[model samples]
Target: MKTTIEKFAGDTEGVSYELTVFRFKGTSKTAPSAYIQAALHAGELPGVVAIHALMPKLRAAEAEGRILGDITIVPAANPVGRAQYVFGELEGRFHLGTRTNFNRDFPLLDRPDKAALPPPPRNATVDVHLKRLLVGLSVGHDIVLDLHCDDEGVPYLYVPAQLWPAMQDCAAAMGVEAVILWDGESGAAFEEAAIHPWLQLPAEKAPLEGRVVTTVEFRGLADVYDRYARTDAEGIYRLLATRGVIGDAKAARPRKFSGVAAPIDRVELISMPRAGAILFHVEPGRSVRKGARLATIVHTPGEPDGSIDILAPQAGYVLTRVSKRSGRAGDDIIKLIGEARSARPKAGALED
Candidate 1:
């Protein structure tokens, strides 16, 4: 086991952030290597605690000489977002300085090599530097897991459409409730950037089945509990063992994934029609019929038509909702996994 602290200079003089990386050596030279990172959004901590719980298991495996492949972990991936707090609330999703998502704008390498990455510009912000540093550390690996969490949702995975059926085993091993498959581009998100380089190579040189890449949403943001962390840790360990990154004779065989598997276009981003306090009639993991009342917005308080009802656009499964009760007009208030392609299919990533 080894630890490295990488420092990146901040936009101002004498300001900097440290990114800690951990590495574990393997006994077999032919085994596939893996990379796991958590909290890229900074405030999302489900993956952070899960990684904390998973370390002891990896240490034990190393001690027992059961670790067969290289493993690298970054329990907290974003030191820049980790320090961003506005007024009293934690602002961790987008970089405050550049207003760019910490997970977006990653360098899409031409090939799966560090040399293929372009040099950062002299005027690049700290966020850009951080993205490049993360890509450099992960692109060379065979498996990459960028751990994150949604606002208020069940455990799920955002897998590239190219890696769907092959990555289902990983999804099943992680015990997530849903799997969303996306194709083309996702604003050059980390998952898209990680797989972009490999797809450039021929199938013989880079068999798609041998690689694993995903942005794991470990349930909602507030689900950072010991029980959930332990469960998620075990799920990840199961994947490592199943993928032959580590040897675990007693690990159970993964069953077929039975969760909702849908394309990115099938998702419905139900936005609020009017800005006001919301009263949700449905939560995540629930089923709804078309035209069912999903929520009500108190737009004009103390009036006859003071509120407006938000109904389900179609029969579907509720995937997530905004954590806040209040929202503005046109803000996405909830997400629904419709039975078919959405009436208004969306492109790119799910959110900005």
Candidate 2:
């Protein structure tokens, strides 16, 4: 077990942030390696707690000489977002200086023409530097898991389309309720950036035979309890064991999984029409039919018949909802997993 602090060039004068990485070295060089990170959006804390709970187990495995593969854990992946605050509230989803999402626009080397790859930009922002450092550490790993959480939702996973079938066991081990599969590049997200380069080559030329990468959404932001953390940690442990990264008796045993994997485009995103107080009629993991009233928005509560009902566009299960009851127009309010009904909006990224 080893710990190292990697420093990033600071955004402001006389200020710099450090990323702490925990490494558990394996004896064999041929063994698979894994990179697990949490809190890329620093406000998402379930992954942070889960990482904390996961550490003790990893330490125990190290002591027992059960570790087969190198494992790297970054409990807090974004120091810049962690320090961002407006008034008394913590703002960690996007950089305050640039308003860019913490998870999007990663530096990727996967180009159509190998020789056409652009050189690294000079005087890059702190976020770009952070992305470069994180990507540098994670590329070439056999498995990469970016732990995150939704505003208010059940446990779910966003897996690349190519990796979905291969990751069913991992999804089972993680006890996620749903798995969203995405193909093509929405944006150069961390997980996509880490795996896309290898995917660009022909099957015969690509070296991504055993690679697995996915974003594991732990749950809602408010679900930071120790019990949940422990459960999530154990799930991760089971996955590592199942992947042969660590030896465990239960590794060979069959595990039951309850989640269903669906295409990302099929997932319905219910956005707010007008800014108002929202009253939700459904919760996460509930099934609904087309035209079902999911929520009601009161644009003018004091006026008679001022409320507008939001209906489900398609039949599916409720996956998540916004944490805030009040939202502005066009805000993301709810998400549902269903058959493809309407085309996705013209957006650079998936999430708001």
Could you estimate the TM-score for every candidate?
Answer: 0.98, 0.94
Off by over 4 Å in 1: none
Instruction: Report the number of backbone clashes for model 2.
Output: 0
lDDT of 1 by residue, 1-352 (tens): 9999999999999899999999999999998899999999999999999999999999999999998999999999999999999998888999999899998889999899999989898799999999999999998899899999999999999998989899888888899989999999999999999999999999899989988999999989999999999999999998898888999966648657889989999999999999999999999999899999999999999999999999988999999998999999999989999988898988989999
lDDT of each: 0.93, 0.85
* Model 1 worst lDDT run, 10 consecutive residues: 249-258
Q: Candidate 1, residue 21: CA error in Å?
A: 0.6
lDDT of 2: 0.85
- Lowest summed-lDDT stretch of 10 residues in model 2? 111-120
lDDT of 1: 0.93
lDDT of 1 at 252: 43
